[model samples]
Target: MRRNIIPIGDVIAVNQMLERRGSALRVHMHDACGGQSFSLRADDGTSADEASRQAVGEFFSARGHAVEFSAGGGDFWAVRP
Candidate 1:
């Protein structure tokens, strides 16, 4: 597994834009080798930020990675468990 830190603000902004367009927000992730990609959809009635966090958590968890959040929720990083 690898550690990848994602900016919270950017994810939230993109999700908000998708919400305004009545489309589901999709978070995509690629494996460390960049050989595979996965997409997770945001759930309805949940804030984009929260949904993003959940999706990221689930993604990392499935691959035996650990997800850690930064102080004040500014960002998150996924790494080997």
Candidate 2:
């Protein structure tokens, strides 16, 4: 089982890396609850899913929650144990 609440430092580092890479992906950290969420969109239409999948596959795969990518808009979309 994966732990949903990862270290805040890891989240920060990931965000920093994203910024450095100029990636459209962004990780939203919930400090009050230690939950993380991300949403991505690309002008090319296909980049959104690709980016979201890659981002989540690399990062959140080990976290407590799994991100389900869709063309939806919500900060807290879904959380699975």
Backbone clash count for every predicted candidate, in the order shown: 0, 2
Q: Per-residue lDDT of 1-81 in model 1, one digit per residue for the tens?
A: 566544455445545655675656555444455433334455553334665656556655655556765553324456546
Q: How accurate is candidate 1 locally (lDDT)?
A: 0.52
- Model 2 agreement with the true structure over 1-81: per-residue lDDT tens digits: 233555666667666666676766555655545445554443344244455456644665555545554455323333455
Q: Cα lDDT of all candidates, in order? A: 0.52, 0.52
TM-score of each: 0.37, 0.46
- Model 1 segments beyond 4 Å from truth? 1-48
